[model samples]
Target: MASSNYEVIRLKRDLPAQGVVIHQITDDRMKTGVPLHDALDRLLEAVKGKVLLVHYAKIERDFLEAATKRFYGKSLPFLMVDTMQIERRRLERTHQSIQSNQLRLAYLCQQYQLSK
Candidate 1:
């Protein structure tokens, strides 16, 4: 996932045994010359044989591919999930809005009896 403020890249190694592992990248380093491929390598080393989950998979894949080509001369591993899409599917099945764009999380919590 690539965002102006933050980027998260995740990968999966095993299935039905181990859960997902996520790597989060944020802060001013995003503005510097630090290569995203290096960051992904570090993240990969941290969780080599674990399943990874991310909010958006396509964006992450694109960014990782580009970053890898620039920094490592090859593409890294490809594995991810889009939680937003999953949530949307669930919400569609339920016929209810899982979240509202007009309402903040705090406001939604108050409106929907969710804990603060």
Candidate 2:
């Protein structure tokens, strides 16, 4: 559904000047934030014919499916590449010992020398 009343998420960059680069969504924002369906509609339209690359699929898949079903009363059909699974498979194939944190997005990115 098309909507003009989407929630606006504001990020204050002033904290970064004080060396705090990570910003957390405050309780105020959480309570005021709109449902995911609105954003999902636009995102799905924009990413048509594009494969989404994500760190973990479970969370993203769950959220997308839930939103799609809730808003449109239909299933969401989309392609997604889970980097965490890919790295896990690679490590398993190479017979390397997998650490608990090895499959994490940040850890996998570090292994592949990806910049933050």
lDDT of each: 0.55, 0.69
Number of the top TM-score candidate: 2
Question: How well is each residue in 3-80 modelled by candidate 2, as lDDT tens digits?
Answer: 223343333322333323233545455456554556676778876787777778988788778878888898788798
Model 1 misplacement above 4 A:
1-34, 97-116
RMSD of 2: 8.0
- Could you give candidate 1's per-residue lDDT for residues 6-87 as a string of tens digits? 3333323222222222222333323443445566667667556655565557776787678777777888776676655665
Candidate 2 structure, TM-score to reference? 0.71
Please give the distance, in angstroms, between residue 27's alpha carbon in candidate 2 and its true position after superposition. Answer: 1.5
Q: lDDT: which candidate is best?
A: 2
